[model samples]
Target: MQRMIEFPTAFWVSQYTIRFAFQEEISAENSRNVRLFRTFLQQALSADLLEVVASYATVTAYVKRKVALQPLREQWYAQQASIEVSVSHTPIQIPLCYDEEFALDMQRVMDYTGLAYEQIKQLHLAKVYRVYVIGFLPGFPYLGELAEALFVPRLAKPRQRVAASSVGIGGAQTGIYPLDSPGGWNIIGKTPLKLFQMQRAQPFLLDVGDCIQFYEITKAEFRQMEVNSY
Candidate 1:
């Protein structure tokens, strides 16, 4: 079966960098295509390629030399038919505690959305969010397409110090603060898991393309997990 998709438009970003734009919109399909093409380019370029970064709808490649469009297009034509995108990976369950002690902006969210605390919590738990991009801070996973009912705007003034592991919702996206940093997202809960541990073999717990499902935990359980994490 020859699966056909619109080939990405590749353009030069700099003397040594090129960017392949898969699509304009952010969706699961666009991400898969960007990742797939990124993999192909890495293998295709081989020795000439320095690094490749896959984002929501773009793949930026840093290379040793310039690349041609026609050959890459031809290569894509030959390979696209055989390769299939798979989103079969199981969702990683992230334990979230929504206790008032941790949910700093709970009342704000409740007031804006016209929902009670339990409703807000349940709605937040309903969907399995995709890791759309990793930015803002290191290891900060921008999970997205939050349920419309839970969509609340970021704070008018960003917080000076959002604690590490604080889970928050900002507009259409939800994310966690991987470290103590200034942030604007509405804080809904906190996770005990260490998202960024430089000492570990894998420094980041989450990456782009990962699926996350958050489950509620008691404040006591949150404390115990915090203890166990250390």
Candidate 2:
């Protein structure tokens, strides 16, 4: 984050949208650019901006068919590299109950990773994972780059209904199921915290570029906590 450098990127445009693809590998540097671009976008774009989304390595700007986009493109080139709006790297702790009652598929995860329960738990809590993007479900954070030893494949068939706050991993990424929704991520734990609340000013608990740290909790504690987890 100390680097006051302008990272390289490629700009692509089509009839309805423009995309700025970060050319380098995903890192804190690229994440900073995304933060800056997101901030600039909100301040620069008006109703002409139909929709905007930032991904792991790209920012997509959607616009109406009749809107001319050259001006907005200029705005990006002028200030997209600024880091004034960079997100805080502070790690937010999420309490997870890994007890069998909540850890729906612990045995499966251990069998696939060839790891003991302690190893799996420690490895996940070892590093503060960065949120690369938010998608798949409302307030569902796509957090990443799991330890190679923790790598596992998705279930052959997706689950019909997963409980909200259920923490799971598929392939190389991990995430929470905000609401009881169909998903394929192998469930290993559940969080007591409310990840999304529609009535709150900021509905989502985690944002792109924010860091997450998971800590263990007991089933009793999970139940003791109030239902309003916001």
Let me know the TM-score candidate 2 reaches against the reference structure.
0.85
Candidate 1 colliding pairs: none
Q: Give the distance in Å from residue 113's predicted Cα in candidate 2 to where it truly belongs.
A: 1.4
lDDT of 2 by residue, 1-230 (tens): 44443433545477777776775467766776776676666667666678888877787778665454577666666765563645467789998888887778789999998899989988887777888889989989988868878888998899999999899988888898888999898888999887898888988898887888988888888887636465
RMSD of each predicted structure: 1.9, 2.8
Candidate with top lDDT is: 1
Q: Per-residue lDDT for 47-139 in model 1, tens only?
A: 999998888999899999888879888988887655554434579999999999999999999999999999999989999988888888999
TM-score of each prediction: 0.92, 0.85
Model 1 stretches astray by more than 4 angstroms: 81-88
**Residue 121 lDDT (model 2):** 85
Cα error, candidate 1, residue 177 (Å): 0.7
Q: Estimate the lDDT of model 1.
A: 0.88
Q: Report the alpha-carbon TM-score of model 1 versus the true structure.
A: 0.92
- lDDT score, candidate 2: 0.78
